[model samples]
Target: MVVACCFGMIEVVCVEAKDIQSAGLGPVTLAIDSGSCTGLTGPSGSGKTRLLRCLADLDCHEGDVSLNGASRESFTPPEWRTQVGLLPAESFWWSERVLDHFPYKQKPELDSLDLSPVVFEQPLRQLSSGQRQRLALLRLLANQPKVLLLDEPTANLDQDNIMRVEALIAAYRNQHRCCVIWVTHDRAQLERVADRSLTMANGRLDGDSS
Candidate 1:
């Protein structure tokens, strides 16, 4: 039941997959906490996205998903979303200027994370792949959610940007004391950030903490 050892301020968290029957995920269970730093490695079509969507209440399912002690169903969609935020594989921007998307006035955190200052002036469509990834993560962090669900966040970035994004995520989690459910196929990325590792095979999550 103890997935990892907790150190400093991180708390222990557990997720039990009772029955993923109708949703096609079957009965699966997994638990993760702080200081594990493991990753989830799986091939395509493994239902990683589906599992994350279910937890975010983006899809309906038969099993129960609780955070702390409250069930996901207990909160309204907006309320639930504010508590549990999901950052998709592809980032979105509505305005031509990159800075138009963010609401915060001062983002010293963005600079500390190694994001380029030019990113604020350039159009979203004109940015390179690494820029987009950092922008997406910045937007998500600005929301200050209690839980974060990330899907391949750094897949398109270079080594420098990848490390920056990893450090940013770790800083956000530590500062906010948030629970992160990251879905990634990159073993190195997982080792760099995750506190625990899990794999999805045939619609079930098995605890593979190594």
Candidate 2:
């Protein structure tokens, strides 16, 4: 196994998660393979979100990180970010209507996620939090990212919405051979969707559970 040295840290980038801030993420180490789902679960402030950010290269740290055998430094930040998508915990929508947000001139099958194309026309504010979350998810999936970083992705949804999100993620993983790192407190959700699981504490990853 090859390890990358970023700034002075040695680690694998396939799916490394570590704390990058001064507070630190508590010394977590984890490696996930391609085309599978891995979960990060723990109490709030356990560095789960920070770990996600580090993998996305959104945070600065001494640990090494890479993707598909290439160091995160190998690609320009934009390229890395585009291929390694992060669905933030809180997303913004500025349009008066939802349909206005997506500019899909050539209508494609929204079927992958079981989302209704017409729902995009509703006002952003009019949609519930769960609907907004689903919309954000659709937007990310539309990008066809190679790696997915989701932060509390279903925090605002009902059972139906949660299932939809899981299905969409699963579909993406199966079809594109993409990797997923989900940060959630939902144990049940993790068990249902993740192929492997890990817990975060302080600033580090615990033993990987499959």
Question: Who wins the TM-score comparison?
Answer: 1
Model 2 CA lDDT for position 95: 70
Model 2, position 100, has a per-residue lDDT of 52
**RMSD for each of the candidates:** 2.9, 6.0
Give the residue spans of candidate 1 off by over 4 A: 1-23, 34-38, 104-108
Q: After superposition, how far is residue 135 of candidate 2 from its true place, in Å?
A: 0.7
The TM-score values for the models, in the order shown, are 0.83, 0.82
| Per-prediction tally of clashes | 3, 10
CA shift at 152, candidate 1, in angstroms? 1.2
Which digits, one per residue and each the tens of the lDDT, describe model 2 over residues 134-186?
A: 77887777677889999999898877777877887898887887889888888
**How close to the true structure is residue 61 of candidate 1, measured as C-alpha lDDT?**
75
Winning candidate number (lDDT): 2
The residue-by-residue lDDT of candidate 1 on 78-117, one tens digit each, is 8777777788888887778766666654443567557768
Rate residue 23 of model 1 by lDDT: 66
In lDDT terms, how accurate is model 2?
A: 0.75
lDDT scores for all predictions? 0.70, 0.75
